[model samples]
Target: MNNYEQVLVALRRVIRATDLHSKRLSKTAGLTAPQLLIMQTIRDLGEVTIGTIADKVSLSQATVTIILDRLEQRELVYRVRSEKDKRKVHAHLTESGGSLLDRAPQALQEEFIRKYQNLQSWEQNMIISSLQRVAEMMDASGIDASPFLDVGPINRDHEWKNPTQRDDRKPDPASKLKAS
Candidate 1:
């Protein structure tokens, strides 16, 4: 195969791998990578705020709020306004959230990070440089992206197998909540 064809094949494999992992995660935990990361952060931090979650996961606060809204609708997470400061709200994982999180698999990026850390520094830098170059070649370098490895709309439920098939797992309405 030509060198450019080889590059295209490699890129396709990477995209396919990410897509497959995402499907596995949804099937197992009913949560996307970002959702799992946010929930894990919430569990670790013990009743944290959305801003804190956004910072921890390197996501926008608005995006975090939207995910929390879906989780809240699923009865997984709860939000409450602090009595001392009504403006400050906190997020806590409900019983269901904790249970689901306990059984959930690690996020795709977490697995990648684990393997990435083991590589020599030079190898890591080379990989970073190569990936950045590929992004530039694809005109995707200017895109704003979170660190999560998800591919679809983060706020929507996983699509059903067939477009004509009805899914009970409808997308939740986004709540204008400052927490959860």
Candidate 2:
């Protein structure tokens, strides 16, 4: 294969590895990578605002909020409005959240980062620069992505319903693609 094909295959393998680990993490800990990252941040920050969590994780506030909803449903976290500033809210891990965290395995990114940090400074810089170049080549520069590499839920079954056939929501571009 050519250099381009090799690089594409390598990238695909990396993505597949990340996706596989994410599924394993979900099965083992019952927490998505984003959810686990949020909980870890809460543990690190000791009561942090949702905005702070979003900033630290490189996700939008809206995305964080949606993840927070899932975590809250699982009883992993609770939000409290600031006493002095009711408009502001902070996230704290629940007792069970803390217990679960103690037993949870390290995230894939965390493992990679730990190993990366152990490398020489120059080596680290080289990898970062190369990855940045790759991102730019793919037109993904400045796109919002968490440090964590987990692709959200995987649907291996490809169990999808046609948009036009659905009883809910309006038809759009995806339906057109399906028709073709």
**lDDT agreement with native, every candidate:** 0.86, 0.81
Candidate 1 lDDT score relative to the true structure: 0.86
C-alpha TM-score for every candidate: 0.85, 0.76
Per-residue CA lDDT of candidate 2, range 69-177, in tens? 7777667899999998998899999999999888877888877888988999999999999889999999998876666777844211112233446445666768899
Q: Which residue pairs in candidate 2 collide?
A: none
Superposed Cα deviation of residue 167, candidate 1 (Å): 7.9
Best by lDDT: 1
- The 10-residue segment of model 2 with minimum total lDDT is 153-162
